[model samples]
Target: MNIFPKAQFLILLSEDLFSHPQETMNKVFQFLELAAYLSEEYLP
Candidate 1:
């Protein structure tokens, strides 16, 4: 039996997120449909 889902999985590395916080968060927010809640402080 498979433990993890094949189609709805996302792998995010800490180093990448730290290096590109704004860009990474933008993608995450968009994926979660929370872009409308994002504030201007999120951008650099």
Candidate 2:
């Protein structure tokens, strides 16, 4: 199976994500266009 070009993705390290959840999630929400539905305390 070939998965490229057609599929978009982002790779983040566990350490980086855990160390900077808010920043990381912001990027994710923006990428998925769900920033409007994101809440500050949602992940907490």
Identify the leading candidate in terms of TM-score: 2
Using lDDT as the measure, which candidate wins? 2
Q: How does model 1 score by TM-score?
A: 0.56
TM agreement with the true structure for every prediction: 0.56, 0.60
lDDT of 2 by residue, 1-44 (tens): 27676337777677766787777777877878775445566343
Candidate 2, residue 39: the lDDT equals 52
Error of 1 at 34 (Å): 1.8
Put down candidate 1 lDDT per residue, 1-44, tens digits, no spaces. 29876645656787777787777777777767775445556433
Off by over 4 Å in 1: 1-5, 36-44
Cα error, candidate 1, residue 15 (Å): 0.8
- Model 1, position 32, has a per-residue lDDT of 70
